[model samples]
Target: MTEANSTPSVSLKLLVLVAILVVFAVVIVLLIFFLCLRGSRSWKRRKLAVKHSSGSIPLVSKEIMVVKTSDLTPATTSEIGDVEGDPKKEADVKVDIGAVTAGKSEVSGGGAHRSEVSVEDPNIGWGRWYSMSEVELATRGFAEGNVIGEGGYGVVYRGILQDGSVVAVKNLLNNKGQAEKEFKVEVEAIGKVRHKNLVRLVGYCAEGARRMLVYEYVDNGNLEQWLHGDVGPVSPLTWDIRMRIATGTAKGLAYLHEGLEPKVVHRDIKSSNILLDKNWNAKVSDFGLAKLLGSEKTHVTTRVMGTFGYVAPEYASSGMLNERSDVYSFGVLLMEIITGRSPIDYSRPPGEMNLVDWFKAMVASRRSEELVDPLIEIPPSPRSLKRVLLICLRCIDLDVVKRPKMGQIVHMLETDDFPFRSELRTVREKDPVSSHADVSIKVPYPPPKHAETVEKSRWR
Candidate 1:
C-alpha cells in the first residue's frame, strides 16, 4: 500500500511540470503572432500614405525593351555601393527598372515595382537624389567608364537602382550663389509642372556636401548633336517630326508665359535646351535662368542671363528680360531649324554672321532657293517653306510689341495649309508677303461694331 501511494505522488508532480511547460510555450507563440501583426500594419500604413501623396506610373501589361545601340548592358538590379550621408538620405532598395529608350544606350534596368517609389517629396519627377554610396554602386564606384557627359553645372553618370530603374544622376560640383539657388528653384518649380513637353524629374538626393538632380535618361542626348554633326545622321527626324517638335516646344513656352498663375519668363530659349523623347516630342529643359513674374502687370527689371546667340537683341544689349525676350530667342531657334546654321558664325562674311539678317535678306531678295537646306534641294512642298520663313520673320520682329504671342504662333503652325504640295512651293513671288495672316492673329477680339458693319455692307 505504501509503494502505490508514492507512485501516485510522482505521477502528480510530472503532470504539474507538463502543464507549466505548455503555458510558457503558449505565451511565446502569442507574443510572436502579435509582433508580426504590428509590423505588417506599420508597413501597410507607410505604403498607403506614400501612394496617396505620390502617384506613380501604374503598371500596365506592356513589355519594356531596352533600345540597344550595342549589346553590352548592365545586370538587373545589381547591388550599388554604399553611401555615407545623414541617415535620412540613405536607402536600401530593390526596384525593377524598365528597358532602355535612348539611342546610345547599351543597357537598362528592369522597371521598378511600386515599392521602389520614393516616399519623400513625391512631387519630384523622374529624378531622385541617391546618397554618395548608392550612386557609387549605380556607377560601379563612379568608375571612369560610367561617366557619360558633363556640363557647366556638373557631371552626369548612368546609374541603375536596385529596382532596375535606369536614371542619369547629375552630380553638381559647385552649389554656390546663383548656381545653388538655381538648383533648388528648378527642383521646386519643375517638380510641380507636369506636361508631355517637359522632362520628368524622377527624384533627388540632397546629401551632405553633395547635391544632385535626377532626370529620365535621354538616350539620344541633345538635338545639336544629330542635326549639325558631321557624323552621318543616326536618326532622320522627318519634316513632320520637326513640325511637331516646334509645335510642342511652342506650347511649353506658351505655358510658361500665360499658363502659370502670375506667369514666368524663360530667359533663355535655344536648340540645345530642347530635349526630345522616343517619339521626337520636344521637351523644354534647363530653367536655370527663369524669372517669375510678380503681381506687376508690366515687365520687371532684372539682370540678363541667357545664351549669347539666342538672347533677344534688346535684352542682350539692355537687360530688358521679359516675355518678348523669350519670343526673340524662339525666332533664332526657328531659323536654325529651318536653315541648320549657327546663330553667329564669325567665319561668315560680316553681313552673314548674323543668321536672322542673312536669312531675312535672302528671303526678301527672292533668293528663296538659296535658303533651302542643300540636303533637301527639292523640299516636299513650298507652302511649308514659306510658312516657316514667315513665322521666323514674325518671331524676330525688332519691336517687342510686334512679336507674335506664342498662342498666335501656335495657331499659324496649326493652320489648314498643312502638309504642303509641290506647286505651293512657289516662293513668295507676290511683292507683299502673305505673312500678315500671322500678325493679324494678335487681335484679341472681333472687329469694332463700326468695322463689323462696314464688313457686312461690303459683303452685301
Candidate 2:
C-alpha cells in the first residue's frame, strides 16, 4: 500500500512541471507579438512624416536631386506664380525643415547632406529645363546653317527662344569620352557663380544620350576671330582697344583666381576661349576644361590636356597643373595680342616658328620693339609697351615659382607705375646634350622701390 502511494506522488510532481512550462511559453509568445506590433507602428509613423513633409514638389531620389537639373516647364512657371500669390499655396509648397533635417540626419549618419536642395528663389524659379523637342525646334533640327561654332567637344548653335530671347546652345559630342562628366562640370562651375566676365549658364538639356548647354548670346565674336581672322590685318585693333581688352581679360582672370570661394583654374586661357560682348567687353568662356582647387591643395596631377601652342611647359611635360600654368598661357595670349601672330605658324621662318621663342629671343637681345605687330598704326606708349613686355616675360618664367600671380599681373597692367624690375637669366634646355636646342630662360621680378608709392597714390 505504501509503495502505491509513493508512485501517485511522483506522477503529481511531473504533471505540475508540465503545466508551468506551457504557461512560460505562452507568455514569451505574447511578448514577441507585442514587440513586432510596436515596430510596425513606428515604421508607419515615420512614413507618414516623410509623406506629409513633402508638398507639391515630388520627393526626388538622392541621385536626381544632386544633379540639380535647371529645367523650367511652362506648367512649372505657372505653379510657381500661383504659390507666390496664394499664402496657403505657399505654405503647402514650403518644405518642413524639421522633418527634412531629421530625415537627412538619419540617412546621412548625422553628416551634412552632399546633395542638399537649395531653397527656390521667388525672383528666379529653379532653372529652366528644355525638352529635346523644344531644343530641336529652336535650333531648326540642329541644321548646318544654325551652327555658329565648333570645337573638339561639340558644336554650338544660335537658338532663339519662344520669347525672342537669343541663346547659344552647345551640343556635346555623343562619342567623346567623359562627355557627361564634362557637362556636369561646366554646369556646376558656372551655374552658381555670376559675373559680367564669366559666361552665364541659362539652362541645360539632358535627354536620352543628348547633352546640351544653353548660354546667353554674346553679340560680338570671340577674341580669336578679331585677333587672327582675315579681318584682323585690314581693320587692326586700336591701341586703346587692345589695352582695354587686356585690362578686361586680366580682371576676369583675377576674379576667377581670387573672387570665387574655391578658386578656379581655367586650363585653356587662349584667345579662342575669350568672347566679347556687344560693348566689346571680354568675357571668359569655355569652362569645359576648368579645374577647381581646394583651399589646402596647391595643384592637381592629371593627364595634360590643352592646346599645344598655349600649354605651359611644366604642365605639358609632367601633367602638374596650377594657377601658375594658367598665367603662362595668359602670357602667351598677351604676346599674341601684341604681335598679331599665331602662337605657332609653320609658314613662318624656322627661327621664328614659335611666337614665344621668338619673343623671348627678341627680349633677351633687348630688341622688344621689333616684336610689335606692324599692323598697329598708332603704337602704344613706349614705357607702357616695355612694361607689358616685362610683365609677359615674368609670367612665362622657366621656374614656375618665378611667375607672377594673376592678381599681380592685373595690377601691373592697370597701373602706370612699374612695380617690379625684371632680370633675365639664361639656362640650358632640358636636354643638356643637344647644343642646337633653344636655351630656356628665367625672368625674375623683384618689387621696385616705387611699388608702395604707386599703390598709395592709386588709392588716394
Question: Model 1, stretches more than 4 Å misplaced?
Answer: 1-129, 175-178, 233-235, 418-460
Q: Distance (Å) between predicted and true CA of 302, model 2?
A: 0.9
For model 1, how does the per-residue alpha-carbon lDDT over 97-120 read when each residue is reduced to its tens digit?
Answer: 212112222323652111111123
Per-residue error for 7 in candidate 2, Å, reads 66
lDDT of each: 0.59, 0.66
Q: What count of clashes does model 2 give?
A: 5
Q: Best candidate, TM-score-wise?
A: 2
Error of 2 at 73 (Å): 2.0
The TM-scores, one per candidate, come to 0.63, 0.67
> In angstroms, how far off is 315's CA in candidate 2?
0.9
RMSD of 2: 16.7
Per-residue lDDT value at 331 in model 1? 81
